[model samples]
Target: MKKMILSALMLAGLVSCQQDFNPGTNGSSLTVRSGTSFGMCVGYCRQEVVIDNKNTVFTKTSREADKNPPVTCEKQTDSGTWNEIATKVNFDAFQKIPETLGCPDCADGGAEYVEIQLNDSRHRVTFEYNKTIPGFEDLVTAVRQQRNAFADCK
Candidate 1:
């Protein structure tokens, strides 16, 4: 009876540890992506940035591919920046936020989106461009800053 109780306690401990684990904290399986798009626009109508444990990639697409084509840039991600953004990630809170907030890109006002993937789970939120997300302000800001850093990619 004592042996069985000990085994049950050990199993409970293991389950609790798994419940508290957050992959974003270590960035081992964390990926963050953000982008902006314009429905009625010239030049590059869409811009995106993806950051993961290994690197950061920036891409821009033009509505008229023949006129401007597309641009892509990549570089190693800075550990400090990655940690700063990773620490701000609260997947539980993020999942509570609606996938689409307000009217995105209505009347060509533009739209922005942020997406996070950890292990096998992923979440994405889209809103009006330049609008703030209630619980994800800091993460969004960090992602936008990272995206802006590649403005000269083209």
Candidate 2:
């Protein structure tokens, strides 16, 4: 029964398209791949690509926002600069996106952060810094918010 349920979930994940996931944190370690591409956004249309432990998404705002926002950005900081991707979008294949974060015209530079989260909070977030990102922190917070949510993961 457990195997059957897991298979169904995998199929659903593939077909779902949203990539926004509500995965129970049960893996030995959560692997996060943060890669920025030039051509196109994978799975979903986003400027930056963030794949979470559950294959969830860390989506960005429109390319315009990255470019010239109605407001203004002086430097590449959290304020005017595009520091973090918005974490609200959920996985839905059918949902239509009016605009998307387009690819960079001339790919300048970006950073990829691969973080592994141990089930134990005591352990450093990753082997290196053991520090966590805002997105990962949101997941941990969500897990804790739910009553006995991580009971299964433990």
Candidate 3:
């Protein structure tokens, strides 16, 4: 009887812990935007993805000199997907990161950026393309995966 009671208590504790870790239950709206750009390239020099509470939008554009219009595609975002990325966000730590890191797009090596807007606050961090930021590896990976999934967007 004691074993059974202890098991039940342990299960209840885990359930409450999970609820606390679930960002979706907090009732705050979140938006994540990630993008890459090249300073000295032509033909789709920029690509970006924006993930909001309800949808994910991807856009690719050419430089003004190329005279090409932007191309975009979008799809609905489910709660599972949102939660996956939202759980990676540590707003307090993110706010401490500098607005810019490394020499972005220096010598046309390319540049990447991630921006997040949660509730009434917004922050952006830009860095050299393909370079990993110390504390943001997981969040960056999640955003990159979402962006790459839309690579064939027209």
Candidate 4:
């Protein structure tokens, strides 16, 4: 009875933390990536920039010739401050970027990405488009500001 109880508790613990586990791939050291919005829109968009704990950066790109297909890649870079670059990208425009990329694999209309940094060591982005959180008028304003910024910049 004692052994069975101990095993059950251990199993429950593992199941609870499943989403928090990181089985480091290749030779990249692992770190906890947290999602925080600088200026959120009605929705979020994927950053497509994979920044790990070590601050190495990567972009999500496609090179089709068969065989290789689409894969998560890491770009070698010098260490620096981590932040979300696509934060200022317009909500609609940003949404289009991924729909063209490879988001169809996981979603029907697809989803947007969110930009987040880990430990301030790596600057990476993510796609964590949640259902439009109500009463976030500030998000709507920021999205408009971003859209205008892009148009005015050119």
Candidate 5:
């Protein structure tokens, strides 16, 4: 009876669209979250992208003020994106980056960050794009590409 019920649930998940299903944050790891905040204007532009093995969510906003509105979009993780993330991201290297790599030398005051959740732990790395540190360029590039992929956010 348990086997039959589990099979039904699996079939249901396969039939659902990426948007219709919510993987929830239960037992899943391997999440990629990237974001940027720039400018000191009243409504600074902010963008964020979150993706896991199955789902992706993209969001952009000027601020909470009425001057700028928010844009949000949802997408299913593509095979290429999933594969790149799985193979290219070396979690070991990511862990080596100082957890508090904040922007000490950023003249512009703008910042960007990428956070990954794996093995039941969440790692966040922050930096200033203009003064990005060496040795972590590839990881930053991979994350920036993922952030750019959601340019059509609605």
Candidate 6:
């Protein structure tokens, strides 16, 4: 009976440790991505930018792409450019934002989404277009500002 009880306690301890584990702080490589998506737009309705430790990519999706042409612009970002953008992002501030920023009364027709993958955790949030939390607006601006930098990359 003593051996059986000890085994059960050891198993329970292991399970508890596993439950507290988080992959995001494992010091692994990660990428942070943010973008805006709006439906029924004229051109380039959807734009998304993704930034990894040393690389970034900006993709533009137009309405015509749905047909046969599949219009899109994909740019490979330089490390320096991505690094500059990284400086602007505040992961702590981002994590503070609520999981979801919904504007039910805004009557907005579009939405914006932000996703951050650090180490082993992925945090994503969506808010109504033209509406955002206080500090979130700055974060979103920093994330979206990379568009021009990526466009100029050669």
Candidates' RMSD to native: 3.4, 17.5, 7.7, 13.1, 10.8, 6.5
Best by TM-score: 1
Q: For model 2, how does the per-residue alpha-carbon lDDT over 1-154 read when each residue is reduced to its tens digit?
A: 9999999999998876433423332332333323233333332222222233333333333345545332211111132111122232222311222222232223523222333232332111211111223435553333222212212221
TM-score-best of 3 and 4: 3
lDDT of the candidates, in the order given: 0.88, 0.31, 0.84, 0.33, 0.69, 0.62
Model 4 has an lDDT value of 0.33
Instruction: Give the 10-residue window scoring lowest on summed lDDT in candidate 5.
Output: 18-27
Q: lDDT value for candidate 5?
A: 0.69
Tens-place lDDT per residue, model 6, 1-154, is 9999999999999866442213234323556677677776676666677876555677767678665333334555565655554554555556777877885224437877787776566678778765655665665676767754555432
lDDT by residue for model 5 over 1-154, one digit each (tens)? 9999999999999766222112333325578888887766456378888887788888888866476678888888886776666555555667778865666326757778888777566778777753453566765677688789887665
Per-residue lDDT tens digits for candidate 1, residues 1-154, read 9999999999999866442225444667888999999999999999999998779999999989999989999999998888888887777678778999999999999999999887788899999999968977999999999999998997
* Cα-based TM-score, every candidate: 0.85, 0.22, 0.81, 0.24, 0.68, 0.59
Kindly state the number of residue pairs that clash in model 6. Answer: 1
1-154 per-residue lDDT for model 4 (tens digits): 9999999999999876432212232224333222223232232222233334344332222233253333334433333222122222223232233322233225344343333222223322233333222332333233323333322211
Give candidate 6 regions above 4 Å deviation: 1-28, 62-81, 88-93, 104-108, 148-154
By lDDT, the better pick of 4 and 6 is 6
Residue 101's lDDT in candidate 1: 96
Choose 5 or 6, whichever is better by lDDT.
5
